[model samples]
Target: MQANIRHQVSPYLVFFLIYNSQVGVGILSFQRTIAAKAGYDAWIGVLAAGCIVQVFIWVMYKLLGKANGDIIDVHTNIFGNVLGKFISFFIMIYYWLASVSVLIAFIEIIQVWMFPTMPSWILSTLILFSVYYCVSGGFRVIVGMSFLSFIFPQILIIVLFIFPLKIAHFSNLLPIMNHSFMDMADSIKSSIYSIAGTEALLMYYPFIRDPKASKKFAHLGVLFTTFLYTISTIVSFTFFSENQLKTTIWPELSLTKTVTLSFLERFEYLYISMYLIIICALIALFLWCSSRGLKKIFNRKQKYTLLLLCLLSVILCHFNGSFKDMLNKYIIQMNLWIFYCYIPILLLVLSFIKRGKQNDE
Candidate 1:
């Protein structure tokens, strides 16, 4: 299922997609989650996880390049249509649930910080409206939103970290390896959800012009975000004490409290407001991938698939609570197993099958 030439985007744009996809709600609160056990040493685990992601990027290209299409193409080629679409459906479900997880996470932030009495459905519907618009324009528009996300709010957000550094205790990161190896593993495990969006590439491979040339850019994108998150982790760790971070729900957002000026007050309100662009772009990318994958598997129009997905996302967001937790738990486990563990093995099996076919021919 090669995308039409007009539907395709420049290979370099993949960097923006990969970067924006991974930069979702996790960054605001991940510092506390990773530090839950590893304490200050968790930043090291982030670096290690970045290295592993780079390796995973290599594995994805090897597999997708061989298939010359998205994951659905590879599945049908190897598993036959009936069994393949069945498996692909589950992957699409994961992508859909992933978008919902990100959606509710931001809604929770807005309700807590800005509008305590606002209903979840109102915010969720407003967000999905933007997501539907971008996704309806096709993959290129989604990628463009990603590009804007990096340029606008992302740059400004990165600059905001400087204010926190003025009061940072760099010495807090001392004795980095003080924790046991198992503790480091726990930190890495927690960071996985924050850094997990790279796997969205599985569905969009065919939409990139000259995907081979795009591979380096994808790795670079991951590298940049990894560095970004690591720095964020260090900033959060340095700004707050170990015990304080544990109690803090959104450490990075709280860091905005330090930014004060005579002209303005309660910077976190402004901070959360600016974050709307970033959140919308991330949700658009994930929903695009999910809808596209389901469209291919079901042989349906993408608009119908996308609309169905948007409606489901709103419904799921409205029912937030234990459901959000359950959704995230499933997504993280599927991400780890489906991409990290299964993809490399799939590459090996694909290589063998291609070899056998060549011999028979």
Candidate 2:
């Protein structure tokens, strides 16, 4: 007999998972990526991007709640049978690609910081299997795992900021708007990429115990995430010169190296070791969401579909050239527009249209 699975995530847990997932390895590289384009005003660019993302998340939740359906049903109502299926299929593909790219990026980060001698294929497969195992266990299990993963964030924040009074120079963040607004605008695309994972809300909406609570939690979650991000960014900037920071690939980790603790020669290693848990949780969340998206769009068997997604992501990770370069070419560009602007605007329009039709009827 098939077992009936229920979504057991509370609003707070939902908030944690979404917030943590959004604050992944992307934060490690965001400063350099955006600073390259926006100069010292990258924080301003990130703020602008956050505002846009919040509006988009609001619009998405409104549309999804109004339609009161999964992604497939939402699209079907908005675009009609054929076109809706087409669009839903497009979204499904997008989610899959995003999941794969995130997985590859996480692996690349590990390779760079911790395991230089490990083979990429072995690392990729191990991580993919771990993600798939959690995903196959169902949403409640994954959310539960996410709550436990919260330990990593607690440890990370504490380790990195304990002696905060001594290590950093606050002046690095001042005179922040030294660059033109035009430069900030040019870098908005990359800033959007750094905070890109929140769109997972579109897929996980139905799992939220009280759908109505999503808006409240999502807003609160975004606020909290922004606060943490800004603090972390400021700390990193304050610790390293803009010129030195630009050369570091993962400035977050590099900044952690400044921390001095008893019984610890290299705290960054401990931080990285703990961060592996956080990244694993993120991978599980993304993989599960991606699988659910495919099942919703195509009416596929969930188990088989998730397995297929895991295999596909592993394959994508193996594609030639640097994972960073591949992500820039494909996932970053694709999601920069889709997650940041297009999908959100589209959802707003759909929500308006659906409400209008209901009132008319």
| Candidate number achieving the greatest TM-score relative to the actual structure | 1
Poorest stretch of ten by lDDT in candidate 2: 1-10
Clashing pairs in 2: none
Tell me the TM-score of model 1. Answer: 0.98
Clashes of 2: 0
**Steric overlap count per candidate:** 0, 0
Whole-model lDDT, model 1: 0.89
Global lDDT of model 2: 0.73
Please list the C-alpha lDDT of all candidates, in the order they appear: 0.89, 0.73
lDDT of 2 by residue, 292-352 (tens): 7677667787788888877777777777467558666777777766666677777777868
lDDT, model 2, position 56: 75
